[model samples]
Target: MRSFLYVPGNQPKMLASALTRGADALIADLEDAVPPGEKETARHTVATWLRSLPAGAPVWVRVNSGPDGLADARA
Candidate 1:
């Protein structure tokens, strides 16, 4: 089992840096790192980034949980 490091989905620079770190998996975090106004943007950005990774490299998305703002964030 390999560990995944949490990287802010909204920060393109950080995401790029993390992808190159040789981690077994990367966790593109849309929950804590992004502010309410940037949730949608972060989701899209993370989706795009995940698509670009190599076949063997795993990318996981950490979405917001629960109802209210958390649910909205996941949406």
Candidate 2:
């Protein structure tokens, strides 16, 4: 986990390729990298991405902190 990479959650191609991007950890960004209006779509994409990750993958989510973030956490 010495190195980390941040990928915008809305990019399908980047998301698909994130697993082997060589970073020690991956952050599927749902905050600033994504536009406000696209948060819902990003959340769905990030949820799918998290579920698809292989066992032992080093990943961390950076959801905004608040009710909106709580909603993302719930997703």
Candidate 3:
């Protein structure tokens, strides 16, 4: 990918605007960029955001490791 943009998962506005930024890849970050208390929220938000996109949306999610990461993967 030519451009890899990191968008904080907890920020809905950013997530919505990210897809149009012309980045080759969009990264929904739910780890260090998000507060501990917001991890779950970010997960749900990111999942929904990804789902709303069309089949060709270049999006990827970066989640914390362990249970949270596994859960994020499933999302």
lDDT by residue (1-75, candidate 3, tens digit) is 688999999999999999788899998998889998988888899888888999977877788899978877777
Give the alpha-carbon lDDT of every model.
0.77, 0.86, 0.88
Which candidate comes out best when scored by TM-score?
2
Query: Each model's number of backbone clashes?
Result: 0, 0, 0
What does the lDDT come to for candidate 3?
A: 0.88
For each candidate in turn, the TM-score is 0.75, 0.91, 0.90
After superposition, which runs of candidate 3 have C-alpha atoms over 4 Å from their true positions?
A: none
Give candidate 3's error at residue 42 in angstroms.
0.6
TM-score of 1: 0.75
TM-score for candidate 3, residues paired by index? 0.90
Pairs of residues clashing in candidate 2: none
RMSD of 1: 2.9
Model 3: which ten-residue window has the lowest total lDDT? 56-65
What tens digits encode model 1's per-residue C-alpha lDDT throughout 18-37?
96787788888888888988
Predict model 2's lDDT versus the native. 0.86
